[model samples]
Target: MKQFFRLMAALFLSLVLSLAGLAPPAAARGKAPERIPTILISIDGFRPDYISPALTPNLAAIAAKGVSGTMTPSFPTITFPNHWTLATGLRPDRHGVINGAMSDPAHPGVIFGKSSEQPWWWDGSGGPVHVEPIWVAAERAHIRSGIMFWPGSTTAIDGIRASDWQAYHADLPNHERAEVVLDWMRRPANIRPGLALLYFGDVDVNGHRHGPGSPETTAAIRDVDAAIGYLRRGLAGMHRQVNLVIVSDHGMAHTIPDHVIWLKDYVAKEDYALVSYGGILFINNVPGHEAKLAESLKKMPAFIHCWGKGELPERFHYGRNPRVPDWLCLPDPGARIMDGNPEHPNDGGDHGYDPASPDMRALFLATGPAFRSGTHLPVFDNVSIEPLLRRLIGLAPGKDRDGTVAPVEKALR
Candidate 1:
């Protein structure tokens, strides 16, 4: 009878300690640790230099505790392309989001837009094919994902959307976005998302309107930092093991009104259809006028460089996609390429520049049980991010991924 009472007492004590989180974790008892949740946070148009203890304390704190580095964005250094690259481990050329706006020959009169969720716009399923994104891969592996306004998240890539997703709403406040992610994180383990994405676009917006160095952009940075602090607090309260990976699609560069390059000034509007314009210009030649258009572009100022579709610099790894127009023209750093004259020719800042430009480098900071503490890594291509994410979520690197885990594996424990 005494032995039975002692056994009961011991069991009761164990239950109490476990309930209080004071007992040895499963790992201590020779069981593997629970799967660590992975959260990817994107700060659009964020440059590595933008992070400092005074400007972004929360991000600074995370950097001090984990891995921090700069990521070279895919060629064109545009938001949509680099985001897709980070999510798919494929370059803009391979992933098909070659530019923020592009046209496909099969879809006549249809130009890809920001809010378009058509799988064809992403994977060319309406034409070329579907290249899977990370969320789709996660779902395929039986892992749930919560996507909060990531580009392509709402779309049915591989005929699968994330288990939970919110449509892109530019009006949505940053804190509210963080709250949605926290709510998702709070779900019971059985239903909780193993992989999630949170995106904040205010920095990009402000950077476009007020320049990367403007006070307005600085305020936006602070606002995002506060939201990060809120998310960190929420995660701590939940006592959930999470790997938080913060990144940016591309960095911003200052642009002035005089810096704008008017496309019509170099090429006749009648000779080609301008599919897209900005720092990079995509022009589809009018039938039978290709040679004339090519000849005219040769007179372009030294600031702009034009290339026939398949003839782009091999280093860019672009122009092969049919969606990329016949002629691709890239302007010098800090210059804008406009299809036509606009009342406001210049924004305060812009991306879409050469990825090699210093101002176009994106941000990378990661912290969690899966990462080495206080680690700083060299600049790596943004494509490598997807492989790292796959590793974090316990997924195997499948076939045809452009990024290798080698660049980022050093930051892992």
Candidate 2:
């Protein structure tokens, strides 16, 4: 009789709750908060002016309905450094991937190339401290991430790798790369990645082989735009909304072979080790010849500017890292610093110039439910992208990052 009374009491309570409309809805119970996906795409070396309706109809359509603006790349305005900065929100000085090809004293006689995948080169596994990139942070927070063709993504940074990543293959066609990303997106929500990165090098490659304004470079731009269009159309077919951001590492500048700063004219090859020579030059003076090398560099023509490592302009925010060379040389626009080698020619196009140069400005565009439509944002730094990405993907602000979301908050809905 007592057991029967307990059951009756439970039924009575349920009935009362239903009458009062206090019972939880069947659809609402046990439901989790929705997670919005974010996709970041990089069109390497794409300039802001390259997004005309005729040249890049797909990109122009995105810009018309999304937030569009120019971004100032970090000091040197190179590929690897700025891309790492976009991922980590730290300057090259802090992240330590200083240039495409660079020397590190920690690994004696080892030069890191653009494709170097050693963990120590990126994560500072055996050297300076390591920084956590977006993928690593997302993975730690139980968010699945997919990285492709982003510099440093090939390595297991901070001992953590994204849920899925691909070793960069230059031969992979841009359209196929987009198709691969779409495949990842087609998975069920529980298995799909919350963050995905896509990259295209056709523009940068053509821009370097041909001048930025050449017909070949224009064809490359249109081709990349078509690939992006494919990705956009695929997302629409899936009936899903994702925060999409498109950017470029840096802009390209046309170069003339006649206006080159041949290093042999200024300093002897034996007097210093040429760490890097191109749009920007870095050299390590041999022991006891620092004074001689400095005096010789001072004689370089006015078109080139020379500075000791720590003496870089305050605006550059560089030179603190030990990987930086002892002597740094920056050539003026349209000029290049070369080693005067008959084999290596720099006649096409180059970057890594002064960040303040108009040619160094990069492209930025974003759109999604998280962003306001038809917003025209003012020029901003590329570092701010990390914070904006974190916000879109629901990650908390990182403590060590140098960027804040304030510059891009106006673009958010």
| All candidates: CA RMSD (Å) | 6.4, 2.5
Which digits, one per residue and each the tens of the lDDT, describe model 1 over residues 12-91?
Answer: 99998888696566767694455779999999999999999999999999889899999999998888888888898888
TM-score of candidate 1 to 2 decimals: 0.90
What TM-score goes with each of the models? 0.90, 0.93
Which pairs clash inside model 1? none
Question: Which stretches of candidate 2 lie above 4 Å from their native place?
Answer: 1-33, 124-129, 340-346
Residue 16's lDDT in candidate 2: 92
**What's the distance in Å from true for residue 24, model 2?**
4.7
Alpha-carbon RMSD, candidate 1: 6.4
> What is candidate 2's lDDT per residue for 1-413, written digit by digit as tens?
99999999999999998886876777767668567899999999999998899989999998999999999999878999999899988888888888888878778888899778777777644434567788898999999999888888988876789999999999999999999889989998898999999999999988878878899999999999999999999999998789999999999989967778788987987789888888889889899898899999999988899999999998998998888899899988678888856344667788889988988899999988999999998888888988888888899998877789988999999
Q: Candidate 1: what lDDT?
A: 0.88
List pairs with backbone clashes in candidate 2.
Answer: none
